[model samples]
Target: MPVLETPPLVHETVVSDRREPFSDIVIIGLYAPKIAREARPGQFVMAVTPSGERVATALGIYEAAGDRISLMLVVVGPRTRELALLERGDRLVLAGPLGNGFQLQALGKNVALIAGGVGLASLLLPAQRLLADGARVHLYYGARTAGALVDAELFEAAGAGVSLATDDGSRGHHGYVTELLAREGRTHETIAACGPSPMLRAVGTLARTLGVRAQVSLEETFACGVGACWGCVVPLERSSAQAPAFPPVAPGETRDYVHARICKEGPVFWSDELRW
Candidate 1:
């Protein structure tokens, strides 16, 4: 079956707004039925404010119910700043949940999840989905201080092995999540991560060095979450000689470079394939 194009979504309101361990933004979305159900774990949506500022908000499918979907975002840019200020009962236009999501099959292997700051949002639901399928999960992350960590309770409640690191030494370990992964991540069957670019890069490097299978979800400035807009393209690769082909685009390209669409093809991809 072909992937159905999600309908244009309409935002109902900002249901929750509270400061957590990461940044200082909390927003929820009320979308159409078409978008809410078809949305996958790694896809994101492009939202436009009434004032006409177009920005891509990359969020994970942390929760969903009926025609309503929830997304957690940090107010960081002019568009995000404007978005976070909306009150209840506000109407906003959105297009999503686009992009290719985390592949579930590869998740069968021994799994480790790494996240930093709000990047954890992208991995939370995927973690839940993984655990529901009886996978042993190890999670690692970092925050500026104890107050900067977000959503640890959710993962802990799910029975996942969780660890933390804080920059100011107010948490589990006094360092970065990568450091935590370095110390405790050995023996994992595979690895998956989402975080700041540097952290993802580190996860990719470490996974390659250890010869573990790894996948990463990248965040980038996107124009059209669909492939038509080249604005969001990043470079990536594939093992052409023996890899399965993704229809439409050629199976793989030179490892040096390939245009990756954060809106359509990704948010999640093999870390080694990316042309960082």
Candidate 2:
């Protein structure tokens, strides 16, 4: 994973655009040039709700280009609902480009990118980077219905081969996306995935069964987007390069793994290195 030479800072930006591809799925574009320039694939931002009465909501950096970046989020609660209500020119405060992103070079020349529902937000940058590096990229995407599978054409346009699956059989395969990946066997050099816990675990299991390595970006509710609160901790193997530095374990302690903050050390980890 590449480190951001500059640390995260609050950027007061204005909404450049907003779109609702589905009922509660919102994509908000911000006129934030600094964020666009610093963001890495798989990293996220903590955006203060426009009302300022609620805690900041963590969102993935969906698209980062010249003078702009977009965030894709589902209106799951009061905070997100407030964010969804913002209009063009609405001011938004963000502390961003946080968390360690995916280690793309280690994934090699052929990669399978797996996404579930809104998890697609974290992956577009990786797909774009992989393609620009001359790698073969394939996307296995899934959603509840055909209508929920948004922005897949963006990947196709970026030169990625796309395969889709929906739970209700509205389009592509009629089952879990992991099933589609399994049916195809091991065709890629490695796998990179982001989605709900069950979907990500399935990807990890499938990756093991196929004798391929995989990296998974975890989705969790963050109280403080930085590592301050230690609220979003995951059990990771002590040997993982992404593990945080800690004091020597006492004689009675379990040395097999360490609790790593998803907001700081991760959001992305080697599937095989995760003890959860």
TM-score of each predicted structure versus truth: 0.83, 0.95
The reply for model 2, stretches above 4 Å from the true place, is 1-8, 250-255
lDDT of 2 by residue, 1-276 (tens): 357765558999999999999989999999999999999999999999888899899899999999999999988899999999999999999998899999999999999999999999999999999999999999999999998999999999999999999999999999999999899999999999999999999999999999999999999999998999999999998888988987778898856789999999999999999998
Query: What lDDT does candidate 1 reach at residue 194?
Result: 83
> What would you estimate as the lDDT of candidate 1?
0.70
* Cα RMSD (angstroms) for every candidate in the order listed: 4.2, 2.7
Superposition error at 96 for model 2 (Å): 0.9
lDDT of 1 at 21: 37
